[model samples]
Target: MSSAPGADAAPGSNPIPAPSATTPTTAIKRQTFSSLKVRNYRLFATGAVVSNTGTWMSRIAQDWLVLSLTGSSTAVGITTAMQFLPMLLFGLYGGVIADRYPKRKLLMLTQSTMGVLGLALAALTLTGQVQVWHVYAIAFLLGMVTVVDNPTRQSFVVEMVGPKDVRNAVSLNSANFQTARLVGPAVAGVLISAVGSGWAFLFNGLSFGAPLIGLMLMRPSELYEVERTPRGKGQLREGLRYVAGRPELIWPIVLVGFIGTFGFNFPIWLSAFAHSIYHAGASTYGMFNTAMAVGSVIGALLAARRATTRMRLLLGSAMIFGVLEMFAAISPSLWLFVGLLVVIGMFGITVNTTANSSVQLGTDPVMRGRVMSLFMMVFVGGTPLGGPLVGWVTDTFGPRIGFLSGGLVSAGSALVIAAVLVKAGGLRVRVDLRGRRVRFVEREPAGERERESVVAGVG
Candidate 1:
């Protein structure tokens, strides 16, 4: 039954009352932590913090274990590459799986698999039955899980926090990860010195328990439901087609691939840089990673304070990152090298966090999983394609040249992308002084629309 209209309503119409102040304003916010206002997000964040710390611990231990066994810089490179190779080969498919499955449920399966793998690796290591090949096998297996886990985690954040709090959530996620990086290596260093690398793996296996529990405890009613799209013909090809059409999407992927392939294989470079250049031991390697983590934490905190996202800042910062990587490569002292790494770490996170947020914000909902998978592919998966080459270069020409080469290539690639984006998008880079930021402004040349039409016809 329609009630009589109030002054706010038209004739024969019912007017809805304005929501009271007590009613939350859920419509306007656009950051990631807004989901934390919901109980479920808080629980998940808490659990993830615990699990991520342990995961970092395992990463440190794994690298150390490989170095201890083979004592070859190239072996560490191989280990790192193996762990990321599956993402190169299968990340796109994993994204397709993510879009089709219930994300939370899929995460549970992947997390459990991770736990079992960690335990098996630990047992083998502790029993003195593990070989270098065994480590490679386990690392490869874990990489496969990560191929799925990474995209799922990125998309899941959107669901947990909704759109409003996405930026904050993304920053906080980086904070959590870097925080783990900060503590993980320090703890692994002490533990490895005290007991063995096996215990570190065992602890990591146990750490998965928190996230597993959090998953089990989530209430079904609280879940954010995204419509499941039917699988279409050429789904993967379609995803590629969509990305190919967008300059913002395609350029960033290209930039990330270049940086990731050339610049960010620090794990492989770290051991060599430490031993060959710095003449340091395992403890020094631990110290180097810890210092980088400290800088990363600082970057994460700074990113958390931003009220808005800026893509130009990301591009400019990426340019600086290349400069810093070059500096880190040629530093004379170990102390200077580690200090340089801190600056490098800071900018690295800035570049990564900005790129990640840009990719997520830029994609269509149905296509998001695939887009993110492609992003992960370029950012992490592409590491292997260049990892061994970087190692061989380091081993052959000296670690300094390896660093120099990576820096030059990264900077060159970024500049090329910037030029392409400027021309393709008709984008003029501008600084907004009042906003204390930089942005790209779209400028259309005379008859640009008609020109586009002519070009379209020609194509």
Candidate 2:
């Protein structure tokens, strides 16, 4: 049976239910924790929290390990790029795999592969046989698996909660990830300082067990399975064709590519702050990350309460996030800089979560995997370019310059995207300070009034 409210109503016999200001069911679903009501999602979220924490721990440990070996921020940037490069190259192929196969089974395989890789890295580090090259190799290997894992994991949310709560589920997912970020780095910091980075890696390797167990315990009957995309020629081309026709999809991907490339060079920036600028160490680095996570959590929670994603919100938040990050780059004191990062983190998460939810919601069910794969490809995969650029900036000029440069590019990109949206959304950017007016002017179908609501948002 169709789950929509009026699905069973006779075509012309019954009076329609009035769409009122609010209803009990709608009110209940508006709550931030609404998605947790589902057993599968709850279980999966529980497992993910544990696993995401471990992932963060491994990330921090990996970067720190690289710095310790090379003493160069550029090397750290390279490591970051290497990890993401595979996703840039192969993310679409993963999407095809995702569409053709069962998502749950694919997740299990990918998750197990990740766990093994984590353990292998831990073994190498603990045995003191680890080198920057070894770390690079392992990071690249991990990214290879993530090419498949990223899209599958992203598309799996709908399977857990169905289409109705997807937005809420995605918001909660970000909240879950940020919460892990908050806890993971703090724990890893202590573990790194007290024992060594090896222990942190080992702990992360062990943390995979929780999610694996959760997956094992899920009831197959409860899974909300979408139609499996059948094998066929030109499916990949079709996915590309679908995205090409939508401006809403194109703009977000384009904007995210810029931000992800320049703005999200955090591993390089934060690492340099600790090792190069602050002269502190692992604890301070972890603290920096934790503070950012704190803001991210808050941003995610706020996103949950919002009615819908908007173009103004996305561009506005990105602009603010970039400017704040630039400001953090110039802060004179470590504490002051850390304080700035907190606010930056908030805006960053706002931009990230909003972009993700918007893209997923706007896409078709069958085409979602490919669409999201492209999104991830542009967002994380752009690291191949951004990482190296930021690294070179950090090494040639200074960490502060790298920081300032990234923010400048990020904020600039947002402005350009805003302009693109203005023209493409059938709206004009008019500044009338003398007339005391500042708002979007909706031009008649003179331009793209059509795609505006679908891509950008309603004015």
Top TM-score hit: 2
**CA RMSD of all predictions:** 8.4, 6.0
Task: For model 1, give the 10-residue run with minimal summed lDDT.
Answer: 450-459
Which portions of model 2 show Cα errors greater than 4 Å? 1-29, 429-439, 443-458
lDDT, residue 24, candidate 2: 30
lDDT of 2 by residue, 350-441 (tens): 98888888788778767778988999999999999899889999989999999999999989999988887777766765556999744566
TM-score of each: 0.86, 0.90
Q: Measured by TM-score, how close is model 2 to the native structure? A: 0.90
Q: How far is candidate 1 from the true structure (C-alpha RMSD, Å)?
A: 8.4
Query: Which candidate number maximizes lDDT?
Result: 2
Q: Residue 118 error for model 2, in Å?
A: 0.4
lDDT of 1 by residue, 129-241 (tens): 98999989999999999988988888777666555455667777887888888888888888888888899899899989988898778764555545444656788897899
